[model samples]
Target: MTFSFEQPPDKLTWYHLGPLLDAEAGRLKYNPEQYTVHGVSNNAVACCWAGLLVDGDGGLVLTDLGRSMLASWKASPVGQRWLAEQAALDEEMSDPAAPSLPAPQPEPQRADQLGLFGAAS
Candidate 1:
């Protein structure tokens, strides 16, 4: 089956990527860091790296790619239909009122953190 830009890469098919996408788009009101993933997830993002990035706090942030893609999609006929759906979703979410997500907190210093294996510091 053909996949749309809204769908994550095949490697990430197992993961529920919509929350991550909505979070990036400011549509999902939840801690973005909670949706954090690395390794394979990073690879998937890399395929379409333009929209997503790891924030300083090890969270995800919507990048220019995300916004641009949405804008582009909204500009097209087919995508405009998708945009209408998204708008409906937005309306639904408006009433339930998910809490607004705050910016990521700074990563704390780990001075006493152990390095590598049995090697002494």
Candidate 2:
């Protein structure tokens, strides 16, 4: 079965299979031997591999094949509309020039016009 962000697998194994087995139901209970059997170098390698799958926007964007599988799922029309509205709201919120409460202006100062700092005048 294809994996996507929308419907991710319960137990995704890559480097170390120990954690993956632990997460899965009816799997051998947290055995360290799973990693050795899988030929995984270390737990850190597994974590790094998982981290690479994450996108810069923090949303888990899948590969072309994954996206194609996700597109097959029938989403509710109302849910799709709500998602669109939320995206629009997010765009407006992130705009730099969005209006805010008026700020008070500070009195302007001239460096050379100060009495002690000024020449004779």
Candidate 3:
């Protein structure tokens, strides 16, 4: 979660917005009149940019670039482990195999759960 930047003495600090554009899709809409150079320095500027993609209901629908970034992250080892842990938790919550639970109890159903033919009853 931490990144270290090492620079030799007397080196000028340079930062670029190119990576931000890549990480967040160019779909980030900015108001030309309201957005000044000074506003770019604010931390909320990033959130403001991302807010453009949000629907009226306040839900974010990912664009192709965002989906690609998510796919790339899911392919990484850490992301894979995180995804696996989430799946395990979901499975445990839905279909608890613990002996303590009473018999004949039905497993909880999720809309997205996949089965051989359809969702298990």
lDDT of each: 0.47, 0.40, 0.40
Stretch of 10 with least lDDT, candidate 2:
52-61
Instruction: Please provide, for model 3 over 64-88, each residue's C-alpha lDDT reduced to its tens digit, 9 standing for 90 to 100.
Output: 4334545666677866887699798
Pairs of residues at least 3 apart in sequence or in different chains that clash in candidate 2: none
Candidate 1: tens digits of C-alpha lDDT, residues 1-121? 1222454333322133453455455554324354455423543355244333334233344455444454555577866676698888888779657666798764545433433245765
Q: After superposition, how far is residue 98 of candidate 3 from its true place, in Å?
A: 2.2
Could you estimate the TM-score for every candidate? 0.35, 0.25, 0.37
Each candidate: how many clashes?
Answer: 0, 0, 0
Candidate 3 lDDT score relative to the true structure: 0.40
lDDT, candidate 1, at 40: 30
- What candidate 2 gets wrong by more than 4 Å, as runs, is 1-65, 73-79, 101-121
Off by over 4 Å in 3: 1-53, 56-58, 99-121
lDDT by residue (tens digit), candidate 2, 1-121: 2223233433333332343322222232223455554333344234324431222232223334323333332154644665588689999899989886688754456443464475773
